[model samples]
Target: MSLSLIFELSIWITSVCGVLVALWLTWRAGKQRDLSALAGFAVMMALWCFGHLALFHGYQSLGMVLLLANPLMPTFFLHFALLFVNEGRACRPWLTAMTRHIPWIYITSIGVTLYSIWVNAGATIRLMDDRPFFVFTESGALNLGYTVLIGVLAHAVLLLGWRHHSGNKRRSILAMFGVGAWGLLLATSFVFPSFGIDVFPYPMLLLPSYLLLLVYGVVRYQILAVNRFANRALLALVMMLLVLCVIAVLGVFSGRVGLEALTNVPIWQLWLYSLVVLLMAALVYPTVRRITERLVFPGAVLNEQVLDTWSRQLNLADSWTQLVSDGEALLRRQLGQTVTIKLPNDTAPSGLHLCIEQGDIGWSAHVEKTDDLSPGMRLNLEVFGSLFASSCAALERSLALAEAERKRLDEQHLVELGSLSASMAHELRNPLNIISMAAYNAPEETRKHIKDQLARADRLVGDMLVYSGKLSLQYQRVPIKSLVSSVLTTLSTEQVSIDIQVEDTLQIDADSHRLQQVFINLIDNGLAYVRNLERGAMCVEAYLDSGRFVCRIHNNGPQLDDVLTQDELFRPFVSKRRGGNGLGLAIVKRIVDAHGGTIVHRSDCGWPVTFEVTLPPDNTEGDV
Candidate 1:
């Protein structure tokens, strides 16, 4: 009602509200570790309000209370600026050091001012009739030094805000206001009248506009209130309180203001007032909450669900196999689609496909690093990534498991090929040895039959050696034109009209013996097919296309049937030639691939079945 009461009430209420807010904020942050700056801001705010209260309560000379507040007040301003700027986390270590020396700094500074007042007669103070107490100090160099020191510290905070200049304009402006406030307060309380003006007063109101600015950043733009649930509850309370006032007023206006029963009752009157208030509040709060939630919490609940689901999924998935199955199911459930995990193959000698899929989602073959894993999760042991992913995640345990299975199957395949080669080599040798012995013992007429058997044995043994992987390579760059000529010469004796259309001087960097063996296999087949006719056509053509040396060997042979489908023709121990071991063409393919190349068998149907061999041209052979 009165000016003094109003002033007293404003100071007490502001002080109490500020402290309570600070306490709640600080306590909320204490439960977590990362929000140190937030907690620091809270504690600083509390100290700041306490300092303000001291000055406001006419307690300045109560053991130097006003001066005691000086150190913390500036510090709270700096810290508040930091937090408001979203740069608080980076500020504290320096301020912690500042706080450590604050006691000494404040005591020394206060001592000088007090000394000047008591002993030097340079400083004084008085209570104003129209104003509160004021510091009456000089416009001396000491006063300038005080303003400069506070300005330097406050400006230091502003300087730090430069990194966030574009990020936090509000903080920057507020810090400037603080610097101005300190400077103005220094001038008015210490320098203004001494220089000739009655007032140039800048006090608590100078910089605090920025607190409202902060509230705006938080409420409208950043909305940091949701970060602390207390703010939300407080908001709910305010809305409810407003609704209560509205309904109480409406009831008082609509009905009798002084009803006997309502006015006479003591407990009931209070209860009626409270009930009316609560009833009105009930009408408005849910609507306010729904509006706020829509604005502030769109997709928030869904985000939480995702986080919870991921945490649970990771917990439930244990082994690589289980991990894969769970991942597949989870992804299917969450994403409503199937997800395939694949890794490149390294040993397969394919480009960018090394480190092949270890397995599906969860497989035991992956010796996963569990140190960084939880009960339901694993870390990719292959910390190194050699291939690109749709996203850059190490193969999950499920995918790793699938890849492991593939590797095991490849190993088993290699083992089976080994055993088949050994059996074929054994079957070919027995009769060949006996025929050679019999031919040595037989007379001339009988010896011819055994010699034929020995020749058959030689072909068998050659195929056996290749299938067994015992064939040695005489590797060197050889001219293909000359090599093909020799193969044609050997097979030309058969009743075949051979046309050689060759790419001359085409050098291949390969095993001459192995290449010769491959050419012989094709030539021999061509001879067999063409020889069946009284006279049949055969041709061998070699040329280069796209860095590959392509050799086409054709004969007037029957078209290859469906039995030799593209996939089946490459299988070892399956031969198309009569009494021929299936190893020859398979061996030819293996040799070509060993030299960093690929070969595919295709039948060119003319009068003849043409076999095509495509070998990757060597870089060295380019010039040769």
Candidate 2:
């Protein structure tokens, strides 16, 4: 082959090689790849194809063909930089905007170049149509400005975004810049009056090398599953296109060439033919992607590679659901073929059993047993019996321990009750003796004077009996309105007002005698606290609320001392009041709570010093 013919062939092959590689990369990127990145690459490849074909079409000097693609060249370079650095979040808006505007940046840069060509300029706009001697000198102020502006801007953007990228990102972006730099150098050789060199477009070849590095990085990271996607598409599409292309080439070249005959054709027609087919494929990509996804993973959101992925994650149970209890797991790992369990003669099945157990406590287990033994069959009788014996023994020991503990607790409770009753009986003796002695010796006139003391003595004894469960509540239908009035009348407070506003017939299932004591304790505290206050104001009100008998006692007194934390106030013998035995409120709380009533204290302004009690409709009869 002659050198020129060889050179032409290589150049044609080089251009063809660029198309093949670009197509493969895009296909590898697949639908899951960012459409913006794919589209950007597609634009670059399409424009580049135009530039190469224009050169081959004997229209190389116009510069318009390559100019059309100049903007995309920088854009494609920036994309590679991003591909290296992107860690899988959607593309940043600002970076995407900058990238999208790059084609305009290139077109704007070429605006001056095109204007120079239009104006029939002197030094920069030279027209020549030949080889080594026909090289033109471009040195007008406009041309220099144009070249410098584009080169500087491209370099500046590279430095800003790509230079500081760390790790493999830095390496990949640097390679992109290296290829871009060479491309610029080639363009510079063509325009500037620097020298005569046929290597003006030589730097363009380095684009593929940089792209190769990028492809390797992609494969290394398994990025986009590009290698697999690209390889499959290349194998399929190339075979289809080549078979059709060659057939068309042969038919065009010779009308009667046999199917077996190898026919050669021009590179130009092959490119256009391949391009027609490629464009048609590109047009159908959306449909192809949808169809392929449905066939592979119907619900897949990101077009994941099915073969590359595992169907079921065996031990992912940890991530899926918590194993809060010890038990069997539906694991993907292999397991024993059959599970055998030994059971005691007396145990019945319960849910959530052991997979296999053998003991005297009786083995409770889950298993796959499919044997029917006739009366004559001896079914490994000794081995099975031994296993059952151990399980049964373990279960029996555990049950015995639990039963012993329960019995001991019951005995201890009975002892505590006896001790309490004895102590209470002894404590009541002295108070009872004092009241009895006073009652026997006092005359009728002095009896009134001793009444208060006698009543207190009786109250103390009643408390002891209540604690011992010997105090019987005389359950009666006590009208709540009448009850409140009785408490208010009996415990008359000169300094506080007792306001009764209950339903006409709010009856309660209560021993009115004991409830009268609960009222006395509450009213006494209200009187003491209110009397000491400068305001000296207190009010007790009763009403129906939320289908219950609600009663509230209010005083404009200072808050209970912080020493009466709510929990402490509920305990017997614990009180915050200056003069209190603390048993009063404790007994009141116990009685009310035991009757399924509710009480709460709200500490706020305007409604300060309040006691709230609510009782459900009772087990007594009343009109309403």
Candidate 3:
């Protein structure tokens, strides 16, 4: 009924709120830094409010005992500020040493205050309008100085850290300082009452509000990685505390003023009884919620309707690209974040990620970690990502099956074509040999022209048979340098300078005749390109690499056209050179394949054109 009682009741309710915040911080301290210190600060603040409550209720000894909590309150506050600003990074050496020694200074101040209280020299209490004022002597006044000094220092640290940092860290520190400023002003007002001042700690009424802002900071800015489930339980606790406070106020009004049947019972004891009930409710909230959740929504991470809607949206997507886009949009819309869906091979940007895996398929949904996102939201994201990955797996299987069928058809067609071409080449070679015999008997000038044309036709027919017929190897120990030199002797290399880099001792088990054809085709291909240069040059290099014999023939000429693919270059009748049959490289490829070797076109190491041949090691081997 009285204004003083109204103020007292408000302070009691908010003090309980502060204690709840301390419990929440303590719960979160394991995963976050500076939270333990903040929890200590909250506890001290709650004690400060209760101490005032005790003094007003005329419990002098208990109130003075509670006042001992004052010295460490700002100490914990400054410690939390320093840690919050540094943000888990190592602080400056001077600041570290200062933080380490600050608590001892506060402890000594407590010692001096204790001695002052023991002497009981100038400790006096006066009553005005049901509010008790404690008059402090010089020793008691020391607490006020400690409060001012440490409180300013904490804010100063916060300001400096906010100014010095950039990007997200700067923004986080700024948010902390902004929320903390309100609590700082209200907390400082409590000091006035300790100095025999008329201040009633009305700021205590907003203690619950100040604590709620910190919770908002934790959820919105990720100042702490608090558990979302715990957040829900804590909300339930706060609500119950409020309900209990309301019930206590009604009881006081009903009994003392309205009903008058229980007028003998004191109002302060009723509030105390309410406080005890609230504490018990806070302790049992988690157990109660667990029991209730099982009865309501069994085995569910979040609201089932929301999860089902997200699942439907994902399943209805027409394509993978659309699915990924829609899923990212959903996350951004619900969580208020910058979201990206990363394919398996994509590099994920730095952030919080919900990784999804279904069998061998895997990808991630990424978001900037600006908040402790709820479990319900995370479960929804996981469901979306899992569906996307599943779709990718199914699509990949379909493509693979189609590709396999296509390759089978291609191989079958090539085999039929090769048989027909081989038969044609054999029949044509017979007529070419007869023409060579007739040309030898003609007149000298006519014979020379006729023989040249006949020889060209014979070479083309021989290439066709070699490329389209079955190739058989006659494996023997062949020296690479000798084989390359023999191939060169059969070619006109007078206009080109050839460099051989094969080791003298290098030998491999391969058909010498077939290997000779491989070099002749490759080196001739290089020479045809380079011989036109003013100072033509070419290099033939061979070595053993990883149990395979490797050879590279490079020429100083213009590189191959970009439009030409390796497959196209090796196919029959796909020549880039003038007046060529084009079966030279095709025959070369067939021979290499027979010998368990591979040939590829390259332009590397400052060479304009190169053909690299790699062969599997056989019975005979020598290191280069």
Report the lDDT tens digits of candidate 1 across residue range 497-524.
8888876768877778778878887788
What tens-digit string does per-residue lDDT give for candidate 2 at 200-229?
Answer: 343433444444443443343345565566
Model 2 residue 199 distance off true place after TM-score fit, in angstroms:
6.6
Q: Candidate 1: where is the Cα deviation over 4 Å?
A: 1-6, 13-64, 67-72, 75-107, 110-132, 137-148, 160-304, 307-485, 488-624
lDDT of each: 0.54, 0.52, 0.72
The C-alpha stretches of model 2 lying farther than 4 A from their native spots are 10-56, 60-72, 75-107, 116-148, 162-168, 178-194, 198-222, 227-312, 318-624
TM-scores for every predicted model:
0.40, 0.33, 0.43
For model 1 the TM-score comes to 0.40
Order candidates by lDDT, high to low.
3, 1, 2
Among residues 3 or more apart in sequence or in different chains, the pairs in candidate 3 whose N, CA or C atoms overlap within 3 Å are none
Q: In each prediction, how many residue pairs overlap at the backbone (N, C-alpha, C within less than 3 A)?
A: 33, 14, 0
TM-score winner, 1 or 3 = 3
Model 1 backbone overlap count: 33
- Name the weakest run of 10 consecutive residues (lDDT summed) in model 2: 324-333
If the candidates were sorted by their TM-score against the true structure, best first, what order would they fall in? 3, 1, 2
The TM-score that candidate 2 achieves is 0.33
Candidate 2: C-alpha RMSD to true structure equals: 22.7
